[model samples]
Target: DNYNAINVDRTEQIPMDYTGVMGVPITFLHKYNPRQFEIVDGLNRYTVLDVAGLNDNAVKNHLHMTEIGGKSTYFRVLIKNRKVKK
Candidate 1:
């Protein structure tokens, strides 16, 4: 898995078929359910490298972090839906 960021305005937009790590808006915490989802990590440069098993110098330009057209995104939480269909 690329472990790339998946930006969405609403939590409902998160794809249920996707079992890989996804970056969701922080607001998702309000409706978070332990049984349905697993908290992976926060979507940031440091955490992205950790989750990707990469060192600090492994990635340049912080590409692993949620960025769009060279611009960084807002705070996001990495998550995986346990109930996603296989």
Candidate 2:
């Protein structure tokens, strides 16, 4: 299955059905409200590994990784919408 990506400039398009981790542009911080969203760290390789309870030495190359349609996407800030129904 393909992953859905919301354009950074079009945040209003965020879907209500997904309550899991979302990778959004870093600039999203400007419009971010702590009450509405929860930051789940960055979407870079290092951070991704950290979140997975892994370390740098465990991985040879740490390319900034976020993917859509199995292609690498630009750097993103990992987040979860707090306002979404749980």
Q: Report lDDT per candidate.
A: 0.72, 0.61
Model 1, 1-86: lDDT tens digits are: 13465666579898888878777889999999999999888765556427666545436644646564666777678888899976
Query: What would the per-residue lDDT of candidate 2 be over residues 1-86, giving only the tens digit for each residue?
Result: 01233434256655656777776777778888999888876654446536644345335654335645556666677678788865
Clashing pairs in 2: none
Model 2 bad stretches (over 4 Å):
1-9, 54-58, 61-64
Question: lDDT score of model 2?
Answer: 0.61
Give the C-alpha lDDT of model 1. Answer: 0.72
lDDT of 2 at 22: 75
Q: Which candidate wins on lDDT?
A: 1
